[model samples]
Target: MNIVDFSKEEFQNQQIEASHLEEILKDFRRDGYVIFKDIFSKDYINELNADFIDKYGHLFSEEYKKNVFRVGHRRIQVSVELKKSFNTPYLYANPFILPVLEGIFNTEFIISDLTCVTSLPGAKYMPLHRDGAIFKGVALAPLLPAYAVGLLIPLIPFTKLNGPTRYWPGSHRSPLHSGAFEGNPNFIEPEIETGSCILMDYRIVHCGNPNQSDEKRPLLYCNYSLPWYFDSSNFRFDPHLIVDDNNYSDIPEEYKSLFQRRNMKLQ
Candidate 1:
């Protein structure tokens, strides 16, 4: 599949067009990934970056934070409450991103995991893998209508040296969905800026490339999935770490519908 590249001006000015969205969904379903370029606001990204540093500067020195940092891998554990520390309403209310989620679940979808990812220098290469549990026994091609999607928002400009995500264009349908499938020739290292978001199928074969740069690459990932689906497959969200708690008071009114707690009882 040919890559769809949108300029900053086009994405910011006329983003979310009906035709463009249809094509995006078409490509996403067929290729397991779609890239939107420079659609997010730089000011927003900068502000959030500053906010994270300000509220959590102490974390940069903590043992837990240091323990998680190694060659080719790094993460800020979910134990640190994020919804209360940084800006989340913007992500939830994003016009360019929300529609992509809508394309998958229409009116009834929710976030499975929202967490921070950082790849420090010497970070090891992560092999291709799924974000959630793969369905039982696949046959010819992989299944369609994946249960979830990963939305990656870079906090800084991404480059091969800084460690960008590597995705196999059409590997979502490969029969060996659960195995370590080789994607040497078909992989793409998309140079996404801080403003562009990478939307991908949860079933897509992808991984983080080793970060060879001196700077730590930071990104915010929101894994969106069906309201009924449980996301214990990856990082589990402890209730104590959740600041919003489904009250919908902190998040913008428009985006509250996108969040649902896993074990919460219905009214």
Candidate 2:
């Protein structure tokens, strides 16, 4: 159940697969962000989408969709099945993803939670904020590491027309300021192709852009973390338990650690 128990050879192989692992670590350490292109395949995305619809249909209901809003206009936030889907091997056990995470976090990690974000047409903009801020009120901050990374996997190509995520690179080192976005010119848009993944530092100042296109911008966001951190999702409702146990072992050891830690903490 503990991540620290993973074999050394397995961990080393993960590093080898993530050949650019050092570069990503450098980016995160210095700029607080990095991107990995085409981490998932089209077939993988399709499978996840089908699984989501089958297991959590209520999340796409009218009521849930109605409550999601953006700062400037109406917005839609799709249902996230963090715990329920965590046990899926395709998600947590991907060879490419686990190694990349290993390079970035450089520690025993776990799959904390995931969110399926579907930005409907006309969705409003999200305010600039850091993901770590979500844990500010919780007493678990000291027990956990300061960094929590979000792996943003776009199910559809994230282009300027679709309101892709934007961030001020290296801004994570600064304190959050109310006027940070006031005429500031450092922000840059990250254009991600379908199947590409972006690894972002939780402290980086970022926001979801509004989708101008007629089509919805769907994305899968998976969060990985060290064992002691707190999860924003209610782990008790996670759908991972419904999956067969054989599927669990197929996932990479790194992800297995993440899944185990979250389950242990919630239990």
Candidate 3:
């Protein structure tokens, strides 16, 4: 329920208060997730949203159905193109999030993927699930340190009418699967606006709410994980993060490590 407000003067000046940063780390560590409210500019978010719709919105059209994978009724997942409006340090290697990520991983993490999950009007609520499976054949999977985290940036406001994600706090540390937490009242579906995002441990128990509004709810989902961890389950059909030549060249030298796992065109 605690949301980090990044619009404060200190945070705006590229300096996050130590206490706020500590709270972010502690909240994520204890709750397995945290919400960042209005951390980005509305104009910037609108640009990305417009570009995303211009490039990939056709996937939702009845006439153009290729490369679309349905995750639930009326909800589909597709790949995101990292070019033009989306090829920036703020979107990928954000300074504001890096510190918290470092605190969680305690190591250099890679930007594993960039995908979009769009829930169309009348979409049904998705079944409770974890984004990835725990380490198979390992008895201590639940005991391991955080390996991967998911960051969800919504193109539009995440309102109660348009599906927002329902998260069961602290369920990531349990050895049991997400189904064990089903129907629990101790869950939260926070309605956040544009310029905000949610970061969650990939092992956490959660699901998307039903979309009751007429608009489409699109979430720009990016996955960040430790250098050695590869998510082989999610992108089985579509390609993972793809960085075009232009975008790749634009990436800062220091942040290139984050895109080491990205698929790129020949130079």
Candidate 4:
């Protein structure tokens, strides 16, 4: 299936029925992950693609000139464009996204950071790791019971051949003991279509499978957590600054809400 074929209008018009939501939540709780097919519209995808290209196109050139990893490679601690993209209101209040989160974590949640990944052909496999590793340095005295959930939206179709994500079904329940499963030979890769989204527990042991196909696998990962936890994007970008004053009047309600700053009191 061509993952990039649908426009934004089509996505916005797509209705997610009650049954689908029930099945999704059930699979998520049972399997640690669930795929919602064709949740994004082509227009949104195009806008996102153009936005990313205009902002980070330089990375591609730099990679070419330096003979470095360009497509389908792991790049961490990247620039702020990815965060800004995720902060866009359309994503925050996505019809299919929020409800699922509310179902699992109840109503209280805020997106903490965004990770944009583009896996080009021949991209190397990622080491299995839990998203909760970020909390390792916090002192136990003030240790809060914060949890993070990863919302992975694929801009391009995801398949075993295109480096789909591999996950351990029940590993989230015992994250510390999940260990590295990618090299264990028992890992299973889930086939996901473009515009599909997957919600995962931060403690789940997982990794990006290597891409063997010729197409690029681009995905946008939005990490959500309670407001008290440290945000991965807080130090790098301010969500407020990215909004254009002139465009405020035209901004969608959802977008406006996502960009609103929250106050976090240190315990």
Candidate 5:
């Protein structure tokens, strides 16, 4: 199955049951992506949405226009401030997410990016692209193991009329580039609930579907990578992420290393 329904699974200390780990990994490794349903509660998602609205609800407002990056025709990616509700561990170091990531890397991983990509009404489909290249100019780039992955949490439910993401299954292992997926019949755009989160390899070919509905669709995008890796693409206008000194200090000791790039002077 493309989506793993974790809502019915048993949980020990808020982590998925051990029995489901194999299936989750299998789907991820084979398809280069997987979706976990019911990763968070609706109340939690509502709170996150509220927090995001407080800061960036008005997309064209004078205060936040400077913080917005025009990613597509009507789609904008805004860097989230790592303070208050945005910096909470429940959102970043989620229990249901970290274990699956650990299995994929089999080593320590660090969070490299945190931003929200909002698709406004009339937002068009994006050019199929990978968030980060594994090893540019290398012949064996596609064959290499995943060096980075993206964790997407939607603040609102992703609907068919809204801008749900479309993915080409198992594309991460192929030598295909962004242009390879056009006219490809094999694609899936799973309608995800607010609490569910999608995990995808960095090399996968995917794009956002147009938002035919009137409501805006905002997705919290988080990238995690091997400690040695850094993303050199997709942030030409903005920095990789934002985390102030106070927020960095608020992170749990175990996850502090994930924000190693944060410096005291950063605003």
Candidate 6:
């Protein structure tokens, strides 16, 4: 299968027509993923990178005390104190994705998880896997609608050396196939730039490749799904809190609605 690409302009009309929506949905259903190129500005990406480095780079430094959280030794998940000031939700909430999400989950969906993954040099290969498994068996596994999707924004220019994500085409509809994690014969590694973003069907079989380069590979991740599913990777807040809790009141009002899907609109 060929890697499909779209532009931000094509989806800039505020309202996406049904025909356009069908075209995108068809490609996603067939290929398991889509790339929107040059959707973000370089300056914006640079700012995000700088901010990430400022916040997480230190944790990786000599002063490392306890802030760094690692999925692996090299895949650092930087937990920002102020989650709201992070990247804007507009990119993830773009017209191209919102329409398809609405079609899958109908009228409502929410962002269950949000975090950034920076794979440093020498990051090992990740075992291919699904983000969530609602159905493990049965004939319906391949035909059931998608319950979750992920939006990946590259914070730096991606190259094979820095380890771009490796994805299997059309695997979103199937059960976990054996030997896929060890390096499947059918996989595509699309080379996208910093301004681009990948919309991935959460059920799709994918894995992170080893970083051959010396630079850090940073990518912001956000997962959206039907309200019923609680993402295992999600950071659930504590209900019992003291007055000295993390100060998040300073975050933008729009950022908070993501937790409840209260502020999202399909149209």
- The candidate that achieves the highest lDDT relative to the unseen native structure: 3
Count clashes in each candidate, considering only residues at least 3 apart in sequence or on different chains: 6, 9, 0, 11, 0, 0
Kindly list the per-residue Cα lDDT of model 2 for residues 118-209, writing each as its tens digit. 77777778777676654444555323434577877877778999898888877666654524764578877878775567777676788888
TM accuracy, model 5:
0.91
Top candidate by TM-score: 3
Candidate 5 residues 159-219, lDDT tens each? 9999799999898888867687899989999898888989999889999999999888999
Candidate 1 off by > 4 Å: 1-15, 60-62, 65-89, 237-241, 245-247, 262-267
Candidate 4 on 1-267: residue-level lDDT in tens? 111223455456654556765766777666566665566666676677667667755655444535433222543222233244444556766766777777777656665655466776667877777666454434441133326778787766677788888877666654344454645765567687655677787766887788799765677777777655554433333341233454444556645554343322122
lDDT of 3 by residue, 56-172 (tens): 888898875554688888888877878988888898767777788888999888998998899999999899998975675466887787899998999999999998999998888
The stretch of ten residues in a row with the least summed lDDT in candidate 1 is 71-80
What C-alpha lDDT values do all the predictions have?
0.67, 0.61, 0.84, 0.59, 0.82, 0.68
TM-score of each: 0.82, 0.72, 0.94, 0.70, 0.91, 0.80
In Å, residue 188's CA in model 3 sits off its true spot by: 0.2
Flag the better candidate by lDDT, 2 or 3.
3
Give candidate 4's whole-model lDDT. Answer: 0.59
Residues 156-244 of candidate 1: C-alpha lDDT, one tens digit per residue: 88997887888887777776653556636767888777777888887788888888888767777777788667656445424412444
RMSD of each: 3.9, 7.1, 2.5, 6.3, 2.6, 5.4
Candidate number that wins on TM-score, 1 or 2: 1
Q: How are the candidates ranked when ordered by lDDT, highest leading?
A: 3, 5, 6, 1, 2, 4
Q: Flag regions of model 4 displaced more than 4 Å.
A: 1-22, 63-89, 133-146, 178-186, 213-215, 231-257, 260-267
Roughly what TM-score does model 6 have, to 2 decimal places?
0.80
